[model samples]
Target: MPESNTTLAIRVQGLEQKVPTLDGELQILQGVDLDVKSGESIAVTGPSGAGKSTLLSLLAGLDMASSGEIWLAGEPLHQMDEEQRANLRGRKVGFIFQSFMLVESLTALENVMLPMELAGAEDARTQAENMLQRVGLSHRLDHFPNQLSGGEQQRVAIARAFVTRPDILFADEPTGNLDQANSARVEDLLFQLNQEHHTTLVLVTHDLKLAERCVTRVQMVSGRLEAL
Candidate 1:
């Protein structure tokens, strides 16, 4: 087992991912090593098919790497089973997806409350309301995802991700679906919350401007990472 680092939010060493394809083995990531300190922001930038999303999934415990050691928020992700990883994620991780993956059947407030509710939090509703208000979504609390516009839905997603105040926040193309104005607004909101919460942010984005906003930046190329 790899030794845990209290000052590190994420540590990846000798990471590799391989999938057996019909043609042959597909290597999506190779020998990836990274260390993100607590409360730091990093952007993973890469072109399509460069294993950017795969790395994010592995680091976030959504999937296991073929070979690697991953320590997330002081927990050994590589050594954990699915259930253990899921529990760890529940306690320390939050995610915002490019598509604004909200529950259509639930209202904005309900969506934001889901994580805390799942964790058996007694004040989930109140915390969710407060987070929504912080994201400027107090007026849209009762609105469903389908009823909201793209920007509004993303705001709801942001509120949901931050409602639990996870130690690490993983955002994949957070503003990919928004217009210029909305993108700027969301960018500001993301950084603001990151600062206030002192959360470690790992973002995967194609937008160079967004990447530049991060304190640290790295680019993925042909399954390898390079400093930018």
Candidate 2:
């Protein structure tokens, strides 16, 4: 755990993002600031095009900010080159997406093992298998993503995200594509991992049930941060 005063795991201050389009320069996020503590769970809620996902992408280093500061685990995201950003993300960040971004060509086990392989962990296979089993996908290890149902595919994706034991997780609308039953199950699994691993969680979700369950709720309006 980080020391009390330094327990912050993610920080953003005075952030701004813009893009040039036919209409004009579009501001996606404006002077947004936030701090995420170790082991904290925060849900960011906003309407579509309010920059929820865009902000997350920036936080995850999948995209760069137009200006201002973003620090993850004390490393300045804006100062890093692409190689450094990729290294940092691989070492500390995990992601879960609404689309269940599983590789179609890989089997469940293979998908889960990819991260460990990249990290060059000697016991990658064992660790990946354990993660898959914990997610209730042990029986489907050899099944390809295309052969699995939506729920099962998501389970595999979740397992993949945990295989490296990331320090923080960024989930974007994790339950969006699922039915109520599947969504509930995935929700349980997510919180279970949080409790078990004490992973820092930052999520952008529209589901009221999931949103309210987070430790904090951040509202965004017109690309500006608002009261919870």
Candidate 3:
């Protein structure tokens, strides 16, 4: 089906981002407009300085845009305060970063269980364990982030992001640190879970193969998006 016929999962209009710098204000995004349908997957591809990550951060509610309208799952981010935005994200958003922001002190199982526990799930440990097993990390449940390889750590992050089954998932260079085999594994896992849960996926990546797997693709050039 066409995207316009589907319900919108995300909507953006006249989005702009500007930051104060030594010289003056730096413009990161300029009048960006976008619409993502429910269950749709989109890959944002661009050069390092083109503001892809900045755009992801805004869309995920990690940071506020300088000016623009952003609606995620029908919630208006621009109109909400920081706390309100955080609450909305907790309920409907999942984010995976390029750096694999896992808690160093927590083991694999514990890391994945944290979100579910915070959300008051009754069986957080059981659910986390099952998610880790699905990612082929059943043997590494007790391993800390430092004890795991980079690929293993990335898988742990992916498990943690998917365990809660969020309405939307935003990933920033999710496979940047993985080997070919593990990258393929992660990609399969991403789409598998996406299909099972009907989750909207938005990822920023430079890998051509990964980008091509998405249903829609866009390029960011000097803070403006162009369809590809």
Candidate 4:
């Protein structure tokens, strides 16, 4: 499919996130501004506690910002409550976590079918099968998460994330737990799927090599974001 008419997939202005501490509030992200065009790939890289993950979370509407405006596919995320944010996320966004957050009890097919089924897609099972096959996990469809290797579990996670054909994909440290070979495989699949589906990608990672693959790289330092 081609990219959407919207030129910008994400737009953030003066974004800030703060958490309460014993003394006062600690700021994680401060005055962050960003714009990601449709079908563009972005990598957010920074050191520990630099708020790279926090920024990604806010952009994906997984967390509320303390202050500022965030527009996701032209939808005003900062003005929405949790329920509205959840609805928006479910309809237009896909997320892949570093932990390979697959349901332990569900088989690979069932896991991948989850989002499609939730969206009331009648062909969820067939699409799930095809997606699993795309990730080279066709034979593992019946396998449980515990029965598969770490790499296989990650593949399942990737399949689940991309099955919905979301408008934007958010990935946080997607290859953090994988070995070199598996990391390469996952990276390839991530880019391949993004290009094929014309999904805007926002990835958070510490690996410079991985970050370099993105069309744009933004670095976070002490709660501020800057282009590198």
- Top of the candidates by lDDT: 1
Structural RMSD, model 1: 1.1
**Order of the predicted models by lDDT, top scorer first:** 1, 4, 3, 2
Tens-place lDDT per residue, model 1, 40-133, is 9999999999999999999999999999899999889999999999999999999999999999999999999999999999999999999999
lDDT of 1 at 100: 98
**Model 2: how far is 131 from its true place, Å?**
0.6
**Residue 149 CA displacement from its true place in model 2, Å:** 0.8
- lDDT tens readout by residue for model 3, 1-228: 234534888999999999999999999999999999899999999999999999999998889999989989887888988999999999999988878999999999999999999999999999999999998999999999999988889889989999999999999999998889988888888888888889999999999899999999999999999999
Query: Please, what is the whole-model Cα lDDT of each candidate in the order they appear?
Result: 0.95, 0.90, 0.93, 0.94
Off by over 4 Å in 4: 1-5
Give per-residue CA lDDT, model 4, range 1-228, as digits (tens): 124525899988899999999999999999999989999999999999999888988999989999999989889999999999999999999999999999888999999999999999999999999999999999999999999988999999999999999999999999999999999999999999999999999999998999999999999999998899
Query: In model 4, where is the ten-residue run with the lowest total lDDT?
Result: 1-10
Which runs of model 3 end up more than 4 angstroms from their true locations?
1-6
Ranking by TM-score: 1, 4, 2, 3
Question: Model 1 Cα displacement at 22 (Å)?
Answer: 1.1
- Model 2 lDDT at residue 1: 21
Can you give the TM-score per candidate against the true fold? Answer: 0.98, 0.97, 0.95, 0.97
* lDDT tens per residue, model 2, 1-228: 235536788888899999999999999999998889888999999999999999999999998999989889778888999999999999999999999999888899999999999999999889999999999988998999889989998888889987898989999999999999989988888888976898888989999789898998999899987868
Winning candidate number (TM-score): 1
Report the candidate with higher TM-score, 1 versus 2: 1
Per-candidate clashes come to: 0, 0, 0, 0
